[model samples]
Target: MDMSERELHETFLPPFKATVDEGVASFMTAFNDLNGVPCTGNQYLFKEILRDRWGFGGMVVTDYTAIMEMVAHGFAKDLKHAAELAIDAGIDMDMISEAFVTHLKELVEEGDVSEEQIDVAVSRILEMKFLLGLFDDPFRYFDAERQQEVVMNPEHLKTAREAAQRSIVLLKNEGNVLPLDKNTSKRVALIGPFVKERESLNGEWAIKGDRNKSVTLLEGLEEKYDGSRVEFTYAQGTTLPLIDRSTQKVSVTEVPDRRGFAEAVNVARNSDVIMVAMGENYHWSGEAASRTDITLPGNQRELLKELKKTGKPIVLVLFNGRPLDLSWEEENVDAIVEAWYPGMMSGHAVADILSGDYNPSAKLVMTFPRNVGQIPIFYNMKNTGRPFDAEHPADYRSSYIDSPNTPLFPFGYGLSYTTFEYANAKISSDKFQSGSSLTASVEVTNTGDLDGEEVVQLYLRDRVGSVVRPVKELKGFEKIHLKAGETKTVEFSIDEEMLKMYNIDMEWVAEPGEFDLWIATSSADESNHLEFSLVE
Candidate 1:
């Protein structure tokens, strides 16, 4: 209505679009703030923004306990007001938000809301329940026989192992120390408090995940190791870091008190090659788990440093949710594997990778910093009016003085035993009309002795926008495989939507101008840049 309040209008709409493209038609709203406002009864999420703009006619379900939390959110006058606002806003059903079922009918009778709206919402909720086949037998999912039959099926275990292997980012390897020979490791030492613990393997949000059923790294090694030839030794070393909270009363388990840190250091001295399984316990990540100090907790850091002085080759295996401070390990450790809580099959996966049965191809999704002060470091950065160039640091550029503005281990950083090279990238056109498609091709060659896979990432920068754009945007990506000494030509189609930049009015438009296409190995720029145009 007014230009002065134009920015406020955009706020009335859903700031982030729900992932409707994922083929999930049912209601799946997060319980918390979506763009700084509660999402449970958010009108922007259901009626005006979702259905009107995104065409999402799917069920709008309440977040867990959100229908009730509205009293705390202060949006509703009472339980009845909460139900009416949510239902009138197009919320069809409630998931653990009991206010809807309790007051929906009463509101309809009083004419505060209508039965037609209630029925409409209830119908969509039932439709999803029908799709899930829950109506046939609501208790079928809880059947113990069915749970036993499907739980950790052989195929699921295999998948868990594969996912584990894929998630293990080899952070550091010096002098070709990884992929150890199974025949050579006659006496192996798995010295860590986590090696036998079951609770740490199953990460947070893991509903119904059996901790007792999990095979720890020590257990996995003992089960696989040839008893006649191979010997296994495990020390109850320091406890790893658990989640840190500034407000909550913290219970720090005395890692050094559990076992003498000196004893563990001595154990490392005698082992053939030390495999130090370290990092945070499961409570450190996921919901409500933010961190101030992202480093090896307890006495683990001191233990590692002391163990390094023993002149024994060390392999570091880290289990964490987000990236951590690993500058010393990256520089010192002979080998490092970033296994983000590999689930029930974590132990077997580590053994497989160590025994050279599986070749890892996991890449870093977030940045690892030198310290906590350099946190929130990710792949994407905004181009300031003055950007930094190392060659010309004195040009009043965009950078930090004390520490480099870059991350220690960048986004898309990963390792395999093999190596790959990219060449011969070509784009089909310099210009594209609205709703048209553009093709970009490239040749990827695996130069190492082992076969592996690489994820080809495509990024775009919308220059001359009515609004500001990130330095680079992850428009498209594809994973490809290559054989040793083999080269394959890969192509990705660039849709017109890739060129659409959000205007000051929040309208997506492909303005007529030159657009730059960046074909890279990761989210960050890897090799070369290609230019193209988007015509009217």
Candidate 2:
């Protein structure tokens, strides 16, 4: 948490504010302590920041065993005191701690805690129950017949497929190896540990999903070309350890079997195009599954190395819960599709994107590091006093001798079957009053051969401020669709509200200064640059 107050207000708090604006019901507090105070017992976070500043009227719940673990942080004397601190900090519910149920009553009787505080928590909890219509009919939502009708209905499945397609980010497409014609392919090799699996497709947190009903990649592709001439061959080249759900840990042995490597490479040599599905095992990511090695697990990358010898165009499809280090695959593979555990309809959605039925338009929300060493890389990072220079390399500059100071893929980065070009960026005025609105517009042209969508990103930077600001901050964005050779003008409105930031005095204000604005496809690129000013 090496961030200033301004950084917290500008970067970390926007998404939470957005959820509150959406009328979300409740919020679960984080586990880590802010500064020295445990988040579960931090009055500043729950009371001052969330309740008072943000006007979040919903209930606040602690994470699993968070209150009981306050003793580990040495902030609480014991379980009883921990319970009092948590309740007093505006936590309305304690999850799995039993700290409240055990000690809250005793604390109230001893005058260590007030009954009014308990009443407030109880009222918020009961209010949620009433909002969920539990009092009207407790068993209303438990109808087995209704569950059957809604679980995997055709319409519901279609929506899931569309969502999966939208979430799939096309990372790299060298030589246009994708958009493979299903009819033209004589033989297609679909090799990976995940090719035939069904459960992992639903990802973690899929509590009630029926894995048996979920379609595998092979099933979905076969369904697409059932009446056609394409044939699909698959091989599981490697295997990783399965996860223990009770402990939320992966169970892996010392030895890994690469027995199927020869078969997979053999299939690749004969096939017209090779589609390799490889990445983190379902349980290798997600909650309580942190890993020091963010690279591909097991012999999967080794399998890719062997497949590369065949010299066949490979479509690398990844299923991960977090951004992975793909420095090697980025250089070797022909195309990359990042589909992060694409739910029950994952296969169908991926097939749609790869087959060109759906042009990929989704962009990355997080930065993909070159390797594990570039752990905290992001697009909106500050311009250091000694920024790295490729042309003028020096020891004092902030850069790794082993790697460049850039991410493998920056945030908002994605590829489509088509391409877009940005030009003619214009601002409404060169100078504006402090509290006035300004418009930034740009022309986006789809110059490729197919219809596609482009996310026009608008980034701003205060040239100088009372306090240091990030090198670039995403102010606004618009997603627009354009047919081949189609041109569209996208516009964004910026006001005093967007320009305000917490200054050195800890007061939010907009300083009169020169500002740099950029319109681009991704945050990394400066497709168009314009200068504007705010006058006092």
Candidate 3:
């Protein structure tokens, strides 16, 4: 993708800058080209910014066959040219690409590449190897006995369960339908593709995990409720279309076969509540899994629509790697849970949340769009010249005629069993000089019946800037727990450092301007904001 220099530095480079600041020892080059130059052969990125400006003394490795891919990017003529370009661009190691090993020596001999460049690359790799003590004990990390002993130990499993519990985001809970009543709801019907599936729970990146050991949603529910008190039934209402990477073929159409629809509907009819486990199969997401449509794949949506006809409360649990088009699910489903590939303890963790054993405290880091049309939707976006006004609906505004400009669920949004009320938001001062700091605080009180955790978010916006700024930027956030009826004060120290950005002249500085601040629940929250100014 062609990107402006300003966009590159402001939008893309900040995270890399943070890694450099944290003294990261290794870096991987991307496969894509930036501004016509392949990342593996991008001299400006490697030499100018990474090495000279940031002083990153790390070994740079090419992503698998990325050096050779530079030829496909048209940045290099051949394998030899690619190797020469990579080494000159400060690349140290080649991952699964024989381009360097096959052509580097010949290129160096022909004077197309220098001995100094090769020496520098070798030294960086050697430095990392030495740091890792690989030279001291070559097979130190390959102990099969120790691996088996620690792989899925009790403590590790407990930690995994806790982590999975915290990672579950409660996207919707209409009529307080969630925290499913195990005691009251006698018959629980687990329906959809993921009801008993275990392999996909480990997700795409888990190469060595034993799928048999992983817990399914069916298994978790059964373990959670007593057989005498609560009876759990399951139905595979739909099957996810099989994605064959080798053949690049899908087993089913977008609206898959409806053979299991009848059985699934029957099961739901006999149940008190229907827990539909659905989402992209593990292979449908993660690396190399790009899609133009990101709705519920195959027959899942059809199955859900059928289940809705049963007049039972449906709790939709989503297992996805990315944000999805959840507009239909949000409006129709009684409750929605984002259970993103919760690993081996997926079932147990989900059961914990559903049974109210654990009040889910996880907030969404990514925004969920209403549809795939809003592919690049985000919380922190610049307000266009003609921003959409909900009060004054105009055709000329920057919005779709088909859909609203807002997301299905905004960033930093999640539900708790309990509710928290924000009050008494105040700042230390209305104005502050550069280099000085100010304090912003707010009081959060648990206003619901159950004790739960809430993520108090702090967002800021520059009223005016040298360049346009995001309407709202998340500056700070704190996840705090409060007992029912308890109150706590959350304070955030704001300084010039938090306000720094690349100005019009491309210099990193905090421009003197009026700023708006909010201490609220989510990025979409615009209630009771305070205004402040930075003096020159």
TM-score: which candidate is best?
A: 3
User: Runs in model 3 with CA error above 4 Å?
Assistant: 252-255
Judge candidate 2 against the unseen true structure and give its global Cα lDDT, from 0 to 1: 0.88
The 10 consecutive residues of candidate 2 with the worst lDDT sum are 247-256
Report clashes for each candidate as comma-separated counts.
1, 0, 0
TM-score of each: 0.89, 0.96, 0.97
Candidates sorted by TM-score, best first: 3, 2, 1
Better of 2 and 3 by lDDT: 3
Q: Write candidate 3's Cα lDDT for 1-536 as tens digits.
A: 99878889888999999999999999999988898899999899999999999999989999999998888888889888899899889999999879988998898789889899989999999999999999998887898998988989999999999999999999988888788767673787888889888889989899888988999998888888865367788888878887876666564344458998998899999998889999888888888888888888886888888899999999999998899988888899999999999999999999999999999999999998999988789998999999999989888889998999899999999999999999999999999999999999999999999999999999999989999999988989999999999999999999999998888999989999899999989988888599899998
* Candidate 1 lDDT trough over 10 residues, lowest sum: 1-10
**What is the TM-score (0 to 1) of candidate 3?**
0.97
Go through the candidates in order and give each one's C-alpha lDDT: 0.74, 0.88, 0.90
Residues 216-334 of candidate 1 have per-residue lDDT tens digits of 88767666664435566677578654433554423554224545566777777777788888877787778777778777767777777877888888888887788888877877878
lDDT of 1 at 235: 75
Instruction: List candidate 1 segments past 4 Å from native.
Output: 1-19, 34-36, 142-144, 185-188, 223-232, 241-248, 252-259, 432-435
